[model samples]
Target: MSDRIMLFLLGFFTLTLTILSISASEDAVKPNSNDPVSFLCHEGEFFIKTRRNHSEANRGRPGEWKTACENEVLELDCGEDKTVRIIDVEYGRSDGTTCHRYPHFFMSCSSSEAYHKVHQRCDNKERCTIVANTDEFGDPCPGIIKYLKVKHRCEPVEPDTLKQVVICENDSKTLKCPKGTYLMIAEAFYGRADKSTCPHPKIKDTNCSAKNVMDIVGAKCDQKEQCELTASNSWFRNPCKGTHKYLMVDYQCIVDDLGYAAACENGNMEIVCKNSSVINVVRAEYGRGHPFVCNNSPTPIKPKGCSSPNEIAIVYGRCQGKSRCVIPATNEVFGDPCKGTAKYLELDYFCGEIWDPEDSPGAPIIKDVTKSTVTFTSEKLNKTTSSEYKTQMKGADEKDWSDVLDGKAFDLGKELSIGGLDPNDQLDIRVVKKKEDLSSCIPFARFRTKS
Candidate 1:
């Protein structure tokens, strides 16, 4: 064996070991949403065990209670196929709480009634996250240092297709599909699209919000048969109360041998932007992945609401028909929908119906450009400082304007190229003199970047 070959082999093994070590470290830090959590539970379960103070004793007055700091939130989530079922609950200076108090509470440990409020929000769900503070759950026995200790277990369940539910306030209907099957499509009608169920309302002008219900069904009900959809504010928010209304759902289920879907496949996101000035979202399906249907539990994406890295509707909505559009898919833009889901914004858009600025009478004309302040700041500098960077139009007659990006390229039908000469560059872009205004401004800036 040659000395060179031996050295090469040693280096290769060293690189392999380093890579494995880094991978192992990442696995430890990145807690998998799908991984079962074992916290203060026996098995297939988790405990709330929340309190302002870690002690079991209660203190404080009835309406005059204060937390040590900001109230803490504890979230217990079950994986994709299971839901957290409260086995038992002993609340209000009591023992455990896995289920009910009947959704009514007075905030006083004067009785065991307040605990019911906690049960209503968490029972039989894939995930339950409640703030461990009197302010959130209400100061049940206000002044006392009370605790919300719940014992819950996850159970395997799926949406059923054999459901026939009548419409009413806060009523939910679940449709269960058989095991090893996926819901291909779901057709739901609330008031009656065909004027079948209580179409003419015996009484006069009763506002049956049929259109709104249909829109909701498209967002939450389609491709799902197992979700427990209710007539409460969560879904339709009561389409019509006074008028007669009932829900009707018809769906088709397919076998799961075909791993990912083709038409409505995994990592599929679609957004239909109307030609109207207002981006009329005709359809927006963020998650079309199987097993990971509407808001799947134990997500691997950050800021929850997302199921996969195929989200495109959000980005599409931002710059669908614009000549120039820049969008950043960050927490600030779409807020955290789910805590830990490997989510991405992917929208399937064809290059059809292009918006040509040269053809439209209302072509974009950004005029009257003056001052531009780019706030830049970071650590070491305890404050934010705005730059004196500004730009002005030199020739309005020639449609002379300027655009300074933090280095971003447009993603439209064609590459939007902007570069030329007004006098030299047609636009003057630079930073003016600094101000001695002695304010809370720092000398640093950071633009949005991908994760």
Candidate 2:
């Protein structure tokens, strides 16, 4: 493609994402949000606010602003006449390619995998506040003195502001305005999913074009309980057929009652399949959701000795089999990741022969086959912080194994599991303090091959 073509594409893509920021402004902030939060500031301006320094991008009324600190709630209240739109954020700092350290840079609107909870909950509204804690956003960066740096500006309230929704390809959703209100679309994009998106769609052709049909959807589904449509040509009239396409609808709902169900669910769940051949674990919830929005729920299960930090690896290590698995919502199993904040364990897995991992000679198996298990040579913790110890997976070749690690550099504990190995293989693990250094690290690991 030529430079002009690339530039045009970039412009179009930005517009598409911009629509998402506008639509579903409230739903976008709820828990389990799939949308990225990169606040769209049409009247572009850049500003920064830190614990030490404070500034505003554009001041409606110039004055000194308040300061925010850790363990405190940061409330950005734009009284009656103004609204705020966040553009970007940087929390803590970065370590190499990852930012998992404490006081980490957790939320940002500028990243491609941008965060949206801040905007969805706060933007274009009168008031919004967020707790500066790791439990709400998880430990994006662990063991770091963290501070939130936000870039945002306030705007005058628009009489004709509309809710926004950015639906991507293969994304079929039902959008409904609050009761007694009318739904309207001010912008629309129906065409190819951008380069930042899946280019060669596995389910559709590659040569796709973008299209806009906000008016069409508004005409048919407005003022109703909900509008249900798929991202296909038949639903929105493809702008370019035979090419991968997605619909971006920017809608604003006329005021009324949006009595959204505020109830949330948080609990430990177990899945069992009978007369099944194989099973595959898709997703699991072993941690707290965003306390402000969605995760497990308002009252997440909080047991004696378990929490989010280690629940995932622990659950998968125990229940990743062909048929049945049980996970308890307790601190004993997961060792409280976030104390005082309730938690839950939810798992999404598929059970079937087709979903099983492939097996080769000396590889992990998922079915009725018996094989050797993975065991550590020593039954003690590797007490050294900087030592590369090797473990072996019996009956499974090293080539057929992958690393499943919890990112603790000097793990006070370790948890690991391997794919492609026998399901019945019993792993023998021991973590003992090293002779050189008496620090205990629990880094449990296993290797398996799927067949």
Candidate 3:
């Protein structure tokens, strides 16, 4: 009976060890073998097939959970047959805490290929939707939505000091700031604002001419608030009257009583004729002479007058009837007596010799005869004593030799009038007696006939 009890005890001990081993295996499997929360999928839904019965409790430590799920809880080699779908997305739990079970949609997927394939299909088809929970339907997946809030994109904001802002109203249209305002911010978006905001001021109506016009010395002005017209500004008036005449003296133009005439320089004077009248006078001829009155007849003649360097002379002479007139020799012939014959004869005859015959010869006779004939000859008075002298005769009829007859032989004197006899038909001759002096025994003669 004791042997039988020992064998039974061994069997009991074996059973106990087997029960412990089974319990341990059950503990390991049971901790991880809860069916993963069922994730439903539809056509084109992005999802991942959970490893069968994977549980959060099977995750070892915070970091060891990955190793625990290798090939079993976490699928490293997923076949095409096992599939899952992402029919919902839970961003936050009901208590407003971050959902730690699946921090992101990617944590629910085992394979990146499955996740990317599902996402691509859903993005193309626009059929995928996300549910916050099993009971609440959530927003569609951003990839599948036609219009999406693009992540990380922000609306532009402008500073408060910006005077103008622009906004895009549609795809092509944009709003702009008003006139008189500059763009400080340029084109940008304001949160929820539809139009552009601009800074503007109220413009007061004022005259531009009031600020432009100034005071000038000779300017003519008119009464007006705004001066835009051409006639409204300062202008120059017509200062001249009548038919205006201009005389250019220098560069300036001056107005005068005779209209517009220029001022004159040094000796120049401008004479403006008024009323169509004229002053005419002949100009005097220029020369150095006494001007005589011109004769008024058809043949004009100039009067006898002396010119610059000469004096006029006048004389009177007596005339006989077509015959030569002779005046008797008297004291009256010597220029009315008191002036004397010598002075009168000196003035008239200029030291010339004159004749006054005492009587007329029966034939041609010499008058005023100082000497009549001169004989020239050479002779030898003695063999050794030769001398020379000239002899003179009183008249042709008288043969009286002069004082030189000392038995000295005579020499001939030269005939002075070899050219022609004077109009008196007698010769007035001078004879030289010696080589030292001319002789005073010279003949002076004249002839007259009574018709």
Candidate 4:
């Protein structure tokens, strides 16, 4: 071949390869073709707090600022699958225009107890509303116009995902997850948040705290199946010289498998997974072995071992291999295993997947839902991945599945529309990642249309 022709061919192949590589990388983060839903392991990390502010608009003249009569109310909704976590709250006239009046125009101050008051009412709830009135929040600036600003985030309801580990000074403890899963630290503190943690006679300095504890522990423990942590001044560099220090850690287990669900007797229970995952029932029981579970009366079912014989088979048949399943926790379903026991249903299951931690995407959390439309958002706790999402709908009672959006694939966290539905119809909806085959695990959400 001619030298010029050889050079041209080499450059052409190199350019083609580069284009292909770029396309593949783009597809990994944002899949753009019609494909079967796939399962990605999403880290169960708590989201960063989002600020929601409510203030009174400026009215009247500049110096003659007239504050609105109505009190400012702050509302937060973290959706059905998550709970509200209050991060910070400020209530007072931070700005002049906000609830500004002639007497309080120049005052710019905030309440010292605003965070405590807001956290008491809204923390760990699905939805909350707080009023910024003198009755609720003491008038910090007296005649000054005031407003309310709350910063909070939503957290998943999976209690098993979070684990707390505490070690006294000079002691060591191991942080471990189940068989295949690894650990991810959510928070850490090397000082005393309270005096009772280590509980020593000389522990009078309860205000002692150390900074960067999370970074110190994360360097030794993140993404590991088991991590040994020691609580000592050598590692944390004691924040308070004379006070006893302890190490406290809040962590999560990153895993595609391991799930738990419970339902009161006679109530319906639902189990769901991502599109690429299937339900694998590990254990199921329908009884009040524990006094706290489904206890309607002061005392019900004292027997610890009361249970139905065929719980495993029944739950497996109903929930296995399907994206979503609902079963009633009634005597009819499991046969009166123990008569008049007032039993509840408890299920333990896992999704089958050994997924890469960095590539997994957290389940979609519904942000808003209406009669004909629903909006949801998904966050990648670690690294971002591109995956096409698809939705499927089924009537709560009827069988068979119907494709939503004409089986079209969309990006993660997009607002999806549900069309051709009758009013007051109960429905179950699930979102899955687009993949080549029909197997996955996805979270399920249920809603009813307005009549």
Q: Pick the candidate with the highest TM-score.
A: 2
lDDT head-to-head 3 vs 4, winner:
4
Cα deviation at 278, candidate 2, in Å, is: 23
lDDT at residue 42 of model 1 (Cα atoms): 14
Model 3, poorest ten-residue lDDT window?
A: 308-317
Model 1 lDDT tens row, 1-451:
6766855765565466557435533322111111111111111111211111111122221111212221455565665555555443333443212122212211223222223333333434445555555433333343333555555556565566223345543466665566655443223456533344435544333435554443344335433335455655445544555554556554445442111211222233333333332221111223322222333334443332333222223443354344334444344454444444433332222222332222111111222221222112112111122233221212211222233332232222222222322111112221111332212111111111112
- Better model by lDDT: candidate 2 vs candidate 3: 2
> Per-residue lDDT for 1-451 in model 3, tens only?
9867855765565466557435433322111111111111111221222111112222232211111111111112111221122221112122211222222211111211222222211211111222122111121122111111101111222233222222211112222334322111111121121112221232122111111111110011111111111211122122222111111000001111111111111111122222332211101111111111111123322322211100000000111011121222223331222221111010000011122122211111222222222222222122233243232222111122223333343223212212221121211111123332332123222121111
| Count of steric clashes across candidates, in order | 53, 58, 5, 22
Q: Which ten residues in a row have the lowest lDDT in candidate 4?
A: 42-51
Please provide, for model 4 over 347-369, each residue's C-alpha lDDT reduced to its tens digit, 9 standing for 90 to 100: 75666433333233444455655
lDDT of 4: 0.57
Worst 10 residues of 2 by lDDT: 45-54
Candidate 1, which segments miss by more than 4 Å at Cα? 1-166, 192-207, 212-215, 221-225, 237-241, 256-451
**TM-scores for the candidates:** 0.23, 0.30, 0.11, 0.27
lDDT of all predictions: 0.34, 0.40, 0.20, 0.57
Using lDDT, give the best candidate's number: 4
Query: Relative to the unseen true structure, what is the C-alpha lDDT of residue 427 in candidate 1, on a scale of 0 to 100?
Result: 21
Q: Which regions of candidate 3 deviate over 4 angstroms?
A: 1-424, 434-451
